[model samples]
Target: MTSKNEITVTGGRLYYEVRGDGPLLLAMGSPMGADAFAPLADALADRFTVVTHDPRGISRSALDDPREDSTPRLRAEDVVAILDDLGAETADVFGSSGGAMTTLALAARHPGRIRTVVAHEPPTLNLLPDAVDRHAEVDEIVKTFETDGLEAAWRMFLSTSGYQEDEAGPPPSDSPEQDLEDGRRFFVHELRETTRYIPDLDALRDGPFRVVVGLGADSGGLLTRRTCAALADELGVPVVEFPGDHGGFIWDPEGFAKLLGDILMTENVRIPLARV
Candidate 1:
């Protein structure tokens, strides 16, 4: 169901996997490794040459120099490096969570290298005119990861994210220590630099690449979904609605893959596909 490979990039080596063999769709998972996308990858592989990889510092990707940590621009460049190493001049891309933020950067900074981009729920708090304070709050949470640990940071995060103060309960894995470490070591570096992130929409429009803003049908009014709607309105296109929530690709990978299969295939459909 999966095929694995490796590619060398600046400052590190990437562990990658290929699933299908069509129009080269590159998928980046949330902070978790590409393995999180296993379900979607299998579903799409038959129709497209699907590619997924661990980001620079996670999983099998080796960072030769620990001092190589950096900004989102550097992470976006890693995506570009992966494509180049695979001999792909350009490809369609789908990025979620922090990965979605990375996708926007790629489109804005390297427009000529992407055919199309779908950025789902990028969590661009800096984009919302009313959400600037929320950005600062999350930044503090990132700081907590440095001072406190993952559990405290996550508790604060879930509480702020409408997790309903123990109403929804803790993650099944519930390893606060592990979470704290991951946040301090990996997320703090990636997310803190990403907080005030806002993409140049003007540049996105002028670029040749087609853009689709995704909102999870189940996510409702979450900041990321609203942000997607705002962007779709600005771009003069219908919001591309998909199944599931912020982490839909992981929660409902089978259904998510089916939805994605349609999105990637029905680009030319007459009726704007609507999800109820």
Candidate 2:
């Protein structure tokens, strides 16, 4: 059974969904929201109670101020709020892309609330040596959005991120207006903070929770792949290879689910089997 619910957060309401029965596992994304992870959640439902949510100001979640810029710390607090609402002391979390940055923040600030975290291809430019250049590129992308328009900004973003539009295809969107709004939010409010987030290496390295950096086997040239490698190196942990590219979970839900389950079980043996 699947249950959809909403809870009041600091600045707005958070919309989330719960599925299946077992240990708590939160599959989340930043701009991507709960809907993006539905297939993966469904695939893991039999063995885990998967919780997915829309980040504030996105989709079903509503922010009191739409213009409010989202930061990793704020989003991390939101995750803790969700856990508190569910009466879950801790949860295994899977965060993809921008969400991975949020997961890192959660692990750093509230390690007690997480059993394990699988951070897949977080675009943490600050971790890389060429971060200055990359950040400049991001600034240019944002500027492009302000000057040229959405499509031009997106084209630049895709190119800089090493995704070929012809090969990877356009990103999925609900509607043109929604897409435009999301794009604007990402470019103007969320992008810079997310990509430039500096992970607390000491906090994560010494945190009680297990932190696993995941990389896509097919993500050779992608900027996120480099970030994943840098993160793994900093943490002194090997990068766990997943099935496909950055959007692997969306493309191969079954395979992604299986691998994620294995990692959680094998890496978190000390975690009790009882449900949260």
Instruction: Tell me how candidate 2 scores on lDDT.
Output: 0.88
TM-score of each: 0.87, 0.94
The residue ranges of model 1 lying beyond 4 angstroms of the native Cα positions read: 67-70, 166-181, 270-276
Error of 2 at 195 (Å): 0.6
On the 0 to 100 scale, the lDDT of residue 25 in model 1 is 91
Local accuracy of candidate 1 as per-residue lDDT tens digits, 1-276? 568888787787878888877888999854666777777788778788888988777656767875455455777898888888789899999988777778888999999889888877777776667776887787788777768876677777766665556634224335655444445545466666664677788877888888877778777746676667666666666777677777778778777777676677777754233332
The numbered model that scores best in TM-score is 2
Q: How close is candidate 1 to the true structure, as a TM-score?
A: 0.87
Query: CA lDDT of each candidate?
Result: 0.73, 0.88
